[model samples]
Target: AEIAGEYLKKGSQVYVEGRIRTRKYQDKDGNERYSTEIIGDRMQMLGARAGSGEPREPAAAKGEAKPAPAKKPAGKFDDLEDDIPF
Candidate 1:
């Protein structure tokens, strides 16, 4: 499960290769307990990352359309002066 979890995300698809194994152990009450799990050997991501509705375009296809830089608000601390107790 750990191997498969690494590739899992919202809206993403994953392929896992593994085998099921069962084991027995003693419980807190001294009763025999059994648990079964898949021991994954490999995992593969099948699609784009989560929250990105569409697949990303190749850098070459993007041409000269670069993303705009984040703009800070005018007068960095002008709005915070009134909120500070000090």
Candidate 2:
């Protein structure tokens, strides 16, 4: 929450990177227990200031473009073979 409060700006989309951390603590009965949290490593701003609510992909380290969509045959499924036993 603290990291979000610090880095997140109003109407701006933010992405955070962190690792899970588990720590031991003492309860009221003096029993040892553990709690987990995400320790932030890095953060980035992606979305626009208009708050359009569109999800943005995470930034690549090398700023590489995503792979193009695979191509499909023009023929329909009905044009294919039917080897099934009905």
Per-prediction TM-score, please? Answer: 0.45, 0.45
Q: What local distance difference test score does each model get?
A: 0.69, 0.75
Tens digits of per-residue lDDT, candidate 2, 1-86, equal: 77667756677667677899899999999999999988878777776534566666666766678887879858988997898777
Q: Candidate 1, which ten residues in sequence have the lowest lDDT sum? A: 55-64
Clashing residue pairs, backbone N/CA/C < 3 A, model 2: none
TM-score of 2: 0.45
17 Cα displacement, candidate 1 (Å)? 0.3
Q: Write the per-residue lDDT of candidate 1 for residues 1-86, one digit (tens) a residue.
A: 66555657566666667899999999999999999988877666666656777764434222467777879756766556686677
